[model samples]
Target: MDSRDWGRFLLPYEQAVEELKVKFKTLRTEFKSRDEYTPIEFVTGRIKRISSILEKAKRLNVPMDKLETGIEDIAGIRIMCQFVQDIHRLSALIRARKDMVVVYEKDYITNNKESGYRSYHIIIEYPVQTSLGLKPVLAEIQMRTLAMNFWATIEHSLNYKFKEHLPSDIKVRLQNAAEAAYQLDQEMASIRDEIISAQQHFEDKTHLVSRVLNGIQDLYYYHRIREAAQFQLKFNELWETEDMWQLKELSQELQEALQRAKRSNS
Candidate 1:
């Protein structure tokens, strides 16, 4: 394809990329706000290389129109997650979207490549409004955890650096690193319950502290310094108590004290 033809093919691909980015940004905001899962970390799109298109066309002796209409990977999206569980969660979210229909699905995580590459791939139909009206287009979505992505990225770089023929020693090293990544994933999964329990404990403690502090500040603002000071002194002593159970008991006592003060003022 000439430069002009290549530009024409890229225009739609670029537009589709922007549209998907906007979609993902809205989903991220929703997730932050407890609105939705939208478990997509990132989305990327690109037009196929002209040489690749030419080669495929030559190999199959297909017409330009047939190639463009049938091939879906001309536009792509990549979703990144922090944990492996997030991949399954996000894939379900994508499948549930009314605006997108799943055309294909591939789970490379379970069936990792010989090079130890792993990820989930999906093809979804996204509608983009054009001068002719709504045009349904195909886009690829890849989902993987941060570790998987890190491994794949390094592997890709190595593949490019070696021009698809990496030295056997380097290849072995890369495979070993990939195995390490797999082990890390397994370790994290095994500790998932303990990790979540600790996280919840911390969040609960944080929430309790915030509530107590805010109440104290309100008392100080309302000319109730005596009560506020009492709250501060009690909390300080609780901190020095060196026992979490004792701290909980003290916090409860302070909460009751604050409630009494509020009732008296009212």
Candidate 2:
């Protein structure tokens, strides 16, 4: 096919990618507001690859118009996560969505690819409304861990750099890197509980800091300047600890002190 035919086939896919990006970004914001554990680091989309598209069209003797709808990955989304478990959660999230209907699924994470690629893929029929009308399009979604994504990305780049032919040494290195990525995921999963506990502690400490600052702001309008200065000094001293647990304990003490001061003034 010529350049114009390529453009014609790719334009709808590009639109689909843009639509998915906007939808996913909005979803992220909504999830954050609701305090949901959305582990999607990023969602990326692309049309079916140009080279693949051309090869398929030639083999099938199909026109661009017929090929566009026939190719499943003309529009695709890749969801990058931090853990293997998150990939399952993300798949559930997508499957549960009323707007996006799952058409097919391929669990490459469980089966794994011969090339050592590990990702969970789902193809969904996503309805998008345009100026013309509502159109149901096929969107391929891939969910994988950050480490997995890193390995896949590097492998793809190397393949492209070597013109789809890699030296034996490079291929071995790529395989080793993929193995390392798998090990990294397992290691991180092992510490998942500890990591989550630390995160919760940090979040609590952040909330305590905000509360302390607000209390200090309120005191400026009521408490004596000398008392407020003493309170500020004590908070600064606690802040210097730089330990979330310690800071949290100190914040509780400071809150009690402020309450006592308020009672004494009253």
Candidate 3:
């Protein structure tokens, strides 16, 4: 097809990728606000380039008119996780979503490829509303741990650089790197609870510190400069001491002061 035709055909796929990215990003934000354990670390998406799509179609023996049915990943989304378990958790979450229908799944993590690739791929048919009507676009969502993604990214670069005709030494090195990455994921998963607990604690402390600092800054605008300065001093002392209890007490105190300031002004 011509460039104009390709653009028209790809519009719905682009919309599907954007909508899915937003939906997953919103879920991550909601989980953060609720202080819940979110399975998603981050998300990214893209609609394949016209040239790449054409090449892929040619390689797969897909007809121009049959591209829509034959191509599963004209649009792609990648979700990266901190742990291997998160990949399975996110896959289940995607399956439970009502907005998209799961067309098929590939568990490469469990049944890894000969090239030592490990990931979970889900192909979903997402309905995109256009000016004309609803168009169902097929998009592939890949889930992987950070380690696996790192290895896959490097492997992809090597394959592209060598045009898939890698020297034996490089091929062996790539396989070794993949195994090391996989072992890293396994080690991290073994202590997943401890890692998650540490992360949650850090996030909580960060939130508390931000709230306290902002509250103190707001107090200065309310003409409570003296009180604000005093609280700032207390916060500095508590921060240096590394005392969690005092810091929480300071946050409560600052919060109550903010409420009083708002009430008196109202």
Candidate 4:
């Protein structure tokens, strides 16, 4: 295809990647707001470059005309998790999504590749609305633990540098590194509860601080400088003591105080 045709053809895939990224990021935010553990630590996405697409197409012997159906990974999303088990949780979440339909899945985590690569991949048919109409496109989602992604990233760079023909020593070293990464994930999983609890505590504190700040801002806007200063002083005390519960209670009290002030003024 010409450059113009290629750009036009890639528009839907680009849209799919951007939309999916936003959706998964929203999920993370929702979980944080609820102080719940999220299987997805973070999400990233991209559309395959034209050069990479052409190379893959050539390697796979895919005809240009058949590229749409033949290339399943033109648009890609990577979801990083804190534990191996979270990968399965994310997979289930993806399967249950109404916006995207899962056409196929590969459990590389359960069945690791010979090169020691591991991840869970799902191919989904996502529909994008355009000026013309709704266009259904194929996108790939890869889910893996943070360690697994770290290993895969290094391995991928090596593969590219060596043109997939790595020296024996380097190949062996990469395989060993992959195993070490897997073991690291296992160790993290063993202490998963502690890790999650720590994260939840942090999120709770952050949310409380945000609420307190917003309340203070509202008080200042209503010309309640004294009340706002008092609340700020209490906030500083609770923050210095690291008292999350007390801070939360203060937030609520401030809210009530502001409401009463509003009512009295009204």
Give the C-alpha lDDT of model 3. 0.92
Error of 3 at 221 (Å): 1.4
Q: Worst lDDT window (10 residues) for model 1?
A: 35-44
Off by over 4 Å in 1: 35-63, 196-266
Error of 4 at 186 (Å): 0.8
lDDT of residue 262 for candidate 1: 74
lDDT of 4 by residue, 159-180 (tens): 9899899999998898899899
Put down candidate 1 lDDT per residue, 1-266, tens digits, no spaces: 57997786666766776788778777877874673333555655556677766766777787887765666677777777756887888888889989779998989999998888889998888887777777777778888877898999999888878878989998889889888998898887789678666765776677667776777787776677987898888777766664567666756766677677678888
Among all candidates shown, the one with the greatest TM-score: 3
- In terms of lDDT, model 2 sits at 0.79
Estimated TM-score per prediction? Answer: 0.70, 0.78, 0.97, 0.91
Instruction: Tell me the spans in candidate 3 whose CA falls farther than 4 Å from its real position.
Output: none
Candidate 2 local lDDT, 1-266, one digit each (tens): 68897785566668778887888778877876785556777888777778877776787787766764667777888888878888888788788988778998999888877678888989888887667777788878888898999889998898889977899888888878888989999999899779767776676677788987777766676655776677688789878876666666756766776787688788
Candidate 2 segments exceeding 4 Å error: 1-12, 48-52, 55-62, 214-231, 242-266
**What is candidate 3's lDDT per residue for 47-155, written digit by digit as tens?**
9988888899999999989989999999999999999999888888889999999999999999988888999999999999999999898999999999999999998
lDDT score, candidate 2, position 266: 87
